[model samples]
Target: MTTRLNPYLGFKDNAREAMTFYQTVFGGELALSTFGEFQASEDPAEKEKIMHGMLTTDSGLVLMGADTPNSMSYTPGDNYSVSLSGEDEGELRGFWEKLSGSGTVTVPLERAPWGDTFGMCTDGFGVAWLVNIAGAQQQEAQP
Candidate 1:
């Protein structure tokens, strides 16, 4: 088995909705486990909340998210951002449209200073994203 690094989002209470929305955007298999299902929480309210949710897209994108328990502190900030970079212009642009929909676009998707097309946006769930469409030369170099 190989180890991989993916984004693990921490939502206050909308892990299910947020993860589901991502499934629409990325077209993936979503597996969700609730606190009750995992027997991880005793409180009835927390039982229905998601303990862990994993979405594996066909494009090899893995996204994980979970609801934050009351016992834990959740501070939303600009500490982290999920980045999507590739040479597929159409595919990446489609992602940009879906991600930026109903969300705030900090940077429009267009030509960037470095010669690549790039953009930044925060989804409705308040998760920040950075999308970059690599130049022709960069794509050919990838294995």
Candidate 2:
């Protein structure tokens, strides 16, 4: 298989639910593994928590999520952001509607300084996202 980069989300305790929700929005296949299944957690309470979850969409979007292990620390911060960018306004806007529906829209989708329609939002799961609809200049520069 070829190498690829994808977003890996870290959740405090809702990895399974969050991943399932993403599957519904993106129309994908979701696979989940619990700490108990992997024998990776010593805490009984955390045994059933998600150790790993992956969602692969038909549009070739791969999203991974996992619950923070009992031994690890989880802090919500501006650590990372998942970015979606393309010239397909309709498709991208469709995603924005679903993703930002119940989430917080820090920046409404609109024209940006670089001329693209851009926005930033934090999903219901507290995941930050950046969506950009490429402008004329960007589309022209693409091969």
- Please give the range of 10 consecutive residues that has the lowest summed lDDT in model 1: 1-10
Q: What is the C-alpha lDDT profile of model 2 across 1-143, one tens digit per residue?
A: 22334676888898889899998899889999888886766799998999768798888988877887767657876434676766777788888999899799988999765578888788999987778787874567669
The alpha-carbon lDDT assigned to residue 114 of candidate 2 equals 54
Candidate 1 C-alpha lDDT tens digits along 24-110? 999989999898886767788899999768899888888877887887667776434676766777778888899999699987998
The per-prediction CA RMSD against the true structure, in angstroms, equals 12.6, 12.4
Listed in order, each prediction's TM-score against the native is 0.54, 0.54
Per-residue error for 74 in candidate 1, Å, reads 1.1
Clashing pairs in 1: none
Candidate 2's TM-score: 0.54
Question: What's the residue-level lDDT of 96 in candidate 2?
Answer: 91
